[model samples]
Target: MRWWDVEALMPLERELFGDTAWSAEMFWSELSHPETRWYVVAENPETTDVLGYAGLLAPGLEADVQTVAVAPHAQGQGIGRGLLDALIHQARERAATSLLLEVRADNEAAIKLYSARGFERIAIRRRYYQPGDIDAWVMRLRPLT
Candidate 1:
């Protein structure tokens, strides 16, 4: 995504992630390293509103799904899957042999989506999230092909 999209994405980020939402500087930092990072945003065709966004970081043979978020109103409409597909494609482009991600354990829908896309739970970080003490599930997908 371009630097211009950062401002447009802030509201959505806060809405989706609440206390853990990323700041504009964080997005800028991620965007600055385009050589090893890939990020995309989905916009409403009519209003141009940010519907979803996803990012991937591929520094070597392994890539990480940095973040993925879909607006609540836009969920269940394939936006998340499409974003994920973009990340997977980007990972492959970078010759990433595997993709990894960490998701809050209570996010059942996200976990199901990752599982359906071939990611398997590799471990769990106890109470990885703050304030609420939520666990985080670490998942991985190998043979990116």
Candidate 2:
């Protein structure tokens, strides 16, 4: 995602994730990180307004999905799935052997989406999230030969 998309993405982040939203500075850093393999902003094909974004970090043979978020108003419209597919494709193209991610245990929709995309629950991080101290489920997907 470009620097200009940060404003639009930040608002969406607040809507979908509340207090857990990533700051503009964080997005900037991720975009500029050398380890970041890909960061994409999904826009309306016709209007070109940013609706979602996904990021991937490759630090060796493994690729980690740093984030995948869709605007609250745009949820259920296949945006998240599309972004995820793009990120996974990029990881595979980079020769990443596995893709890993973490999702809040209470996020059923996210869990379902990850499962549908071939990610399996591999472990859990106890109290990985703050405020309410929610647990996080670690999931992974192996690259297909």
The TM-score leader among the candidates is 1
RMSD of each: 0.6, 1.5
Q: Point out the worst 10-residue segment of candidate 2 by lDDT.
A: 29-38
Global lDDT scores for all candidate models: 0.96, 0.87
Clashing pairs in 1: none
Task: Give residue 32's lDDT in candidate 2 (0 to 100).
Answer: 83
- Candidate 1 regions exceeding 4 Å error are none
Error of 2 at 134 (Å): 1.1
The list of candidate 2 runs beyond 4 A from truth reads none
lDDT of 2 by residue, 1-145 (tens): 7778888778777877788878999888887875556799998889877799999998768999999988777889999999999989888887889999999999999999999999999999999988789999999998733
Q: lDDT score of model 2?
A: 0.87
Which consecutive 10 residues in model 1 have the weakest lDDT in total? Answer: 124-133
TM-score of 2: 0.91
Shift in Å, residue 69, candidate 1: 0.4
